[model samples]
Target: MNITVHRPGDLTSADRAAWTALQSKAHLNGSPDLANPFLSPEFALATGQWRRGVRIAVAYEGGEPAAFFPFQRSATGVGRAIGLGVSDCQGLVHGPGFAWDARQLLRACGLVVWEFDHLVGGQGPFETGASGSFPSPVMDIDQGYDAYLGHLRERSPKFTRTTLAKDRRLARDHGAVRYVHDERDPEVLAILMGWKSAQYRRTGRSDRFAHPWISQLVRRLFHTRSDSFAGILSVLYVADVPVAAHFGLRSERVLACWFPAYDPAFSRYSPGLVLHLRMAEA
Candidate 1:
């Protein structure tokens, strides 16, 4: 067994494929949603380009890449899960049976300590670092949109009906409804950024967009187009004007919902909910 560390941008083209395959095993061997966008080589690549100290440790067993651990390291030896706040799931992408000493692995990465929140279960080495865990709400569309909606219909009939009715009313009252998934127009994304900032201030929360780095990261990610990971900017339009929108990261099969906001002028119609529903279907 061996561990090879490299800056994200230094990764060879072949390393990306191996890392992606290892990530795939994480999904197929367990929950499909384990295939998080943040774990994709694309995320690491983007972050490496945007910031310094981004490192990835590729563990090879029997001369083959077996696992991947990506993190950002401080000069003082503190390490954090890559893309921490924006990443929904965090972990070393490994085969189901893979296990290693957490401290040893951290040391291999030249880290004295490692920290992570939202670390996925089934990770053996990092178990000792976990103080506690919390449940995060996630929509499981593994059964496809219709099947999941069927479950929603049975579970919350009124809620589902009301949301759908509002969707219809929104379309009728406005003009034709146009839900664009994977929208690439930078102007539309700028609008989403504005709406999100206003909402954060209105709700008395710290606006993340206020930070230049955070804003820059999103802008950099917006241009990322890869087979395993890409930015998904979805917009809900009424009468050809943008109403609600969400920007997220997705692999071919999994989507990590990130920035989601809507025009408050249309708040009465609950455009955010409507946009989410459309995103799920797409």
Candidate 2:
């Protein structure tokens, strides 16, 4: 296999189309997680706008695209997934049955260590490099919202009751609640970032939004709209005031929840949970 590295923006229309096709095929026939918008070429393109080191390694066989690896690198030879901090899915999107040596790929990309947290399943090339593994929660909502809710209620009746009761009380006390699945307002997006930043500080976690690049990247991603990759900014409002909001990436098959936050003033109401439930129901 011949490997060629290029900036994400350098990809030609044909290259981008092939990458999307390969990802879609893999999502249908291999791991369902490949359907995540974070794994799409569009996402890499958007991230590349704000990130300097974003590159795509395309492996070719017989002068045709075989696989695509999108990542960002540091001057110290360290590599990470493109949009690492905010991206929920990681790893290369390849054609079916395609395989390559992980170390070979890393060397080809001039990286000594490639770090990834949410590596998708069915990756054999990188299995040996994995030091530990943990389950990433995924909700199977293929059965529609009501069916999934019933399944949840069956599994955790008390939890479901409490969550629903809180949602009802929230709505009652703060006027009727409204949920916008794909909110386009830029101000709401800013509000989400602010809330997320405040939540990070409150929990004593490193605030990702503190970085100007991350903030710029998210704002650019909000305007990215396509069939395969679109920014989904969902907001929950009470009495016409935004109480909770979530900014996530979505494809036709999967909604990969990314950043979520709520007003601390409504902590007792669990507005975050209500927002997520409404997102699922929508």
Candidate 3:
């Protein structure tokens, strides 16, 4: 096996194809953490805006691409997983039964310590170092919308009742309720950014919207579509205007939920929570 390091923004079309091929073979799941979007070439390119230390490690065996590691080198000779804070999964994307020396890769990338928080299970080289587990609640939406709602009712009776009542009240007082499940509307993305920014400010949190690159990345990702990490944007509408919206990634069966926000005008009605219920049904 041979390994080579490529500087940020140096990957060619062929390198991208090889990386994508390796990712496809890994059979990524929808947790947004393990899915390929954050690990995709496009994402790495965008992440260069925030993290200027990005690099790609491509390993080849018999002249065929076997594994691809997307990582960032810090000033302290440490390598952190790419998209460290924002990405749900942090690990190597590789072909079946692929194996490599983690220390060697780190050294090649000029790093001493490699750290990752959300490393996916079954990452051959780094699996042993994963220290803890993080719980991500998921609702299966495979059996059609009604069936999912039934599952929700059975699993979370109180939550279901309260949310349904809220929905009813929202419709009665505000206007008729309308939902645009899996809506690809750009307006919804804009609305979500506005609400998310407001939430950050009202709560005294750092505003992600204050960063131009982060904002640009979100907007760019909202429009990106590919097999590995296609953006799935869904919205809940009232009188033809989006009141609630969600942005996530759909990789196979898993739908990794990311940003979700609702119109503050409808906050009393809890439109955001209502939108989640509808999303689980979709």
Candidate 4:
């Protein structure tokens, strides 16, 4: 096996295609989380453009690409998952039956330590490196939205009734309520960021958008659209006004729930929950 390192933004079109192919193939191995959009080359590239040190290590066997490791390197030879702290999914993406030593890959990339959080499944080699692990909540709607709602209603009938009643009240008080699953408006994204930032400050937590690169990266990603990866901005509107919004990334199989916020004036309507339910239904 041979390994080569390249800046995420510098990867050629061929490289991007191969990377996407490997991830898609990996999804076939019963690890659908491998299909998360955050693991896609486009995400790495968008993040690389706004932040320094983003790199992808491509490993080849028999002159064919086999695996991809995307990370951000520190000055002291430490590595972290690309778009760390924000990316909900992380880990190397590899084709079936491809194997390589983690240490060797690290050395090839000139890193002494490679750290990851929320690492997706199918990473047997890195399992020993983990000191702790936790379950990542994922909404499984493979059986269809109707089945999911049925299950939700069965499990949380009270919660479901409350949420539905609030949705009705929201519509009654503020005109018809509607949901947009894939909103393409850039202005809506800006509004979501502002709401998220305010929510952060209100909770005494530091705002993620306060960092210029994170903000720019998000703005740039909003424009990125592809078959395997896309920026999804879902909004809940009442009387043509957005009461809640969520910006997330989507791949073929997975919809990563990222930033979610709502207009505080509509808190009684539980707009955020309504937006999530509508997003899931869509």
Every candidate's lDDT: 0.85, 0.88, 0.75, 0.89
* lDDT tens readout by residue for model 4, 1-282: 999999876688987898888767665776677788899998998999987788999998899888889999999999998998899889988877777788988999999998888888778888889888899877788999999989999999999999989999998888999899999999999999999999999999999999999899888888998888889999999988999999999887788899999999999989999899899889
Per-model TM against the reference: 0.95, 0.95, 0.84, 0.97
Compare candidates 3 and 4 on TM-score and give the better one: 4
TM-score, candidate 2, is: 0.95
Ranking by lDDT: 4, 2, 1, 3
Candidate 3: clashing pairs of residues: 33-88, 33-89
Q: How badly does each model clash, as a count of residue pairs?
A: 0, 0, 2, 0
**Candidate 3 residue runs with Cα over 4 Å from true position:** 25-36, 127-131, 182-187
lDDT of 2 at 115: 88
List model 2 lDDT by residue over 53-156, tens digit each.
99899999989999889999999989998888778788888877787999999999999999887788778888778888889887788989999999999999
Which residue runs of candidate 1 sit more than 4 Å off their true CA positions? 31-33
Number of residue pairs clashing in candidate 1, backbone atoms closer than 3 angstroms, sequence gap of 3 or more or interchain = 0
lDDT of 4: 0.89
What global local distance difference test value does model 1 have? 0.85
CA error at residue 47 for candidate 3, angstroms: 2.1
- Encode model 1's per-residue lDDT on 1-282: one tens digit a residue: 699899877777887898787666666687454578877788877767766689999998998888888899999999998877766778887766777888889989999998898898677679777999787678898889999999999999998999999999987888889999989899999999999999999999999889777788899889988777889899999988999999989887778888999999899889999899899898
Model 2 segments more than 4 A misplaced: none
